[model samples]
Target chain A: MGSNNSLAVRCRSLVKSYGSGDAKVTALRGVDLDVREGELLMVVGPSGCGKTTLISIIGAILSQDSGECIVLGHDLQRMNETERATLRGGQIGFVFQMFNLLPSLSAVENVAIPLLINGTPQKMAESRAREAIEAVGLGSRPNVLPSELSGGQQQRVAIARALVHDPKLIVCDEPTSNLDHDTGVAVMDVLRGAGKKHDRALIVVTHDPRIFQFADRIAHMDDGKIIEVTNGASAL
Target chain B: MLRVAVKMLMGDRAKYAGLVFGIAFTSFLVTFAASYFTGFMTRGFALISENPTVDVWVMDPAVRSVEKTTNMAASALDRVRSIEGVRSAVPMALGTAEVRFANGQFQSFQVIGVDDATLAGVPPPKDGVVPAALRTPDSVIADPGGTSGKLQTPLRPADQWPGGGPRLDVPTRSLTVGDELLVNDHHVTVVGKSEALPRFPPRPLLYTTYSNASRILLPERRRMTFVLVSAAPGVAASDLAALIEARTGLRARTSDDFKADTVSWFLENSEDVGDIAAMLTLAMSVGFGVTGIMLYMFTTENLRQYAVFKAMGASSRMLLAMIFVQVALSALLGTGLGLGLCAIASQFAVEAEYPFRMMWFTPLVSSVMVVIVSVVAAAISARPVLTLDPAIVFTGR
Candidate 1:
């Protein structure tokens, strides 16, 4: 553990459920995890293992039935809709399983959405988004929409969008599931560079083991709970 | 954000174009209905519209419209002229009579009598010198052919007539300046033809000097239908009208009040007005239904994109603003297109001699309705967006 950096997320006894009564299914039972700034954490699990539910709660996109969950220093369940939305726009970034780039917008415009949502001026937002796209080495294809880009390129654009505003924490769900092994490694390399920054942390949830080498720590989850976490070097 | 909203809308060209079409059609219906009502209302007051120079019309108090007025004593015209603010008041007469044509067809005609000296209410002749020809004692002027034919035909079906009515063969030309016709068993000459404002049931028109009308019809004690008045310089017509009412003990109304009174009277007395109003109601309902349904469908189809926006940290307020922007742009473009259609239809109405009068308020009312359409549509479509959970973007469902 790096003792110098501050804690980015603090969780205790986090429990979330779906539906009710006979139809109820528990997605997260009781969980505790601490992610420090400047670390890349990977969560690996089988299907229906609640990895996405955990990150959704962390991203403030969902409300847990009961929890002592805090993200970016705010309790996920206590904040009102507006406050949580503000926190989501200004402090957190999210990447989902599929490359959910807005098909209507060009790559640069899609990348600029987070900054624009944060009330950044369009000109500056686009400039910063271009820089983020360039960081991913897809600078030449910024003007085409997601449909025109390859699967790997679209994920890069999604990553560019997530980091375009320099968010403090990024919660990524299945960042490389759709890519081939080589393309997945390439995308993870770009993501590793983006998340290894000194001031931000990334929590990526995926079943793809090829990217385990890029993480500083690997979290193993099963049956609605975290079963193990190990240093990446030790796991190798 | 607005740019994204626009881009998203453009992404679905079929829905986008469909929404615009729905809005434009609604706008056209609303605007055209208002204009159509305005056209018919003005037609009800066609007498005043055709004689715009008359500032006031003086008649008996029971007169609801100029066309349906009770005759007053000729002395009422003298009393009107004697009022202080009355610039000029001239006696006028109105009558309906039957004239025998050369084809043995006896067509009915609406006759208007103007002052012999001033021709105060006579429109310019369509075929011959009007006031000059009207000065001859036996002369009368008929309307141009279309109105003349319509008016000459009795409104009821021919089989319903007491005598099964007159047979119409080849339609005869309108009474030109040289035609002779027998009226009330006396021969009268058609000295001129004049263009008059058209009325429903198209009345055949005749214009003659007061003396000619007085001798042509059966003798009656009262010879005047209305005392047409003009305001003196710097005097408001209403002020002159009040003064004339006080002096003459006759009702005097400014042109605007008279026109409104005529329209209201038509509404009360005629079923045709009710039919027009029903049509207007139907038009608005159709517009409302179409716009609401189309906009709601658009929102439903784009629900996933909105969820994606919400997942990307777009607030509910932001999502609503985006929808409002889309609706506002649609309303503006649709209203413009609808008004353009109205303008084109107006041109066609003019060519067809349809009694249509377009005023500023017609378009103004339609634009207001369009705004209501946009807001109501937006409000309805916004509920789905507001309820959309941003988490749906991640569930991969």
Candidate 2:
């Protein structure tokens, strides 16, 4: 989503090629996009349209071979892997499509992980994690494991995990891809509510057009490049 | 933290099993090998370990231990008798011979010829050796040293001499108890079975008069191979040894010195024993190495999960401590079980007549080996963990 004078993400000629020279797949080809602080943006595309790859680059989980991706005033291309990891942990939270919760941990424990990683005391982290879990409407099931929760409940736990650390940006990759339409709607509502309530930038990558209604802006991708950027209401 | 570590390790029962089994196998190998070697060494001292009744062993100056055959003229006995602090020195003769039993079966045996005068070892019930009886012309007493003999009536005084002469007649055919048999095919023996020192060897040992054994077994008979000397109540062994050496110019060894020398001789000369010991040591080392590698792999596999905790912000030191504690606890379980098994096996070995002795040091040595193996295993396993990127939680690919 574009903000008039406030920028949270900046990219320039970002190029990411997989594999060595002879047998390579270019996931992102010199595409650039900007996300605004406190904005809820949905990146929509068909499969293999570089939506996930672009999000990965923005979140500092993957590197671009050339060009620049600046997030929170730090250049992802120049920072070492370790430095990127630190920045990601400190400022970014993630919600995966499959709800990647540690199977051994309870919902609250899963949520507390990022906080724990950030050196929060266990008791304090778990308490904050409980608040986030409750905020997602699963207050009573905080002790339940991800496997024990419904598809929507699991997604909420993932969202809680991402938000409990109070990160500046939330990167949700296909947050509703594994859920039914009703559960997907519920997950998007929780994600939007949490994003707006905390004033954190939320970037959701998805192929499902139904969830575009929850986005403040929509960015469409095709042939490994973003072809259109518009207000979500315009796309609807 | 320890509880978490324990739960995590126990949660994957199969992985912990692999680590435990490796350590258990190593413990068995190291413990068994040390015990076996120590048992073999102890076997050499079984017969005369206590040094009963006598303190010093007088041998040829060249004889370092009992394994070496020493010779001294019997005339040396007189000189020993004259030495101060020397209570008495009894002459003993040792030789090897082929004995043809009544069944016409032949077997080689070691013979210890003692002075008949002392009856020092006459058929049990009679303790001291008597010269008067041993010197009874051709009369011979057999105190079992070689083959176990049967008891029979003492021979007739007149028959003690052969053809009514001073020497007895040698029998050509295999004979029964009381029947005359030639010793060295020379002086005949009135075979008398004694309970003392039975199962000594296969050949028949005749305890006859020194004079008779001299005439029968030795060409010179002027020297005796050994003199079992018991010291006076107040005289120390070194004093007696010095006294005897000064008077007789012969070497004297204390019982412990003789036993040690004998063991050294055996270790040097017996290639089979040394080879077995060397092979066992090599096998034990290989066992330890294999266990170490296996443990490292198990820990390596589990280290992926450790990265999850690291991503959770657990310190590298904390994670290492967790792995080490897990390994140490598993090793404790495995080694405890191994030692228990060894103890049970040792008991069975004793009952089954296997010469097995497990000294306290055996387990100590095994524990040290286990610790070393575990440390090496942890080191290799820790490599994967130390290099783990906490970013994997995010990359999730």
Maximum-lDDT candidate: 1
Off by over 4 Å in 2: A1-9, A13-33, A41-66, A69-90, A97-112, A115-133, A136-138, A141-159, A173-176, A205-213, A217-236, B1-4, B44-271, B278-290, B303-319, B388-397
Task: State the lDDT of candidate 1 residue by residue for A1-236, as single tens digits.
Answer: 33346889888888989999999999988878888887888887888888888888888888888878888788878899898888888888877778788877999999999988888999999999999999999999889988999999999999998888888888888889899999999988887787775467889998888888888888888988998989777766
lDDT of each: 0.81, 0.71
lDDT of 1 by residue, B338-365 (tens): 8888889889987887767678988888
What is residue B357's positional error in candidate 1, in angstroms?
2.6
> What local lDDT does model 1 show for residue B75?
81
TM-score of each: 0.87, 0.66
Pairs of residues clashing in candidate 1: none
Which sections of candidate 1 miss by over 4 Å? A1-6, A18-26, A42-49, A207-236, B73-75, B98-100, B106-108, B144-167, B170-174, B182-187, B211-223, B232-234, B247-249
Instruction: Give one digit per residue, the lDDT tens place, for model 2 in B205-272.
Output: 45665556666664753447667677888999877887778778887766676667766866787685
Assess candidate 1 and give its TM-score to the true structure.
Answer: 0.87
Number of backbone clashes in candidate 2: 13
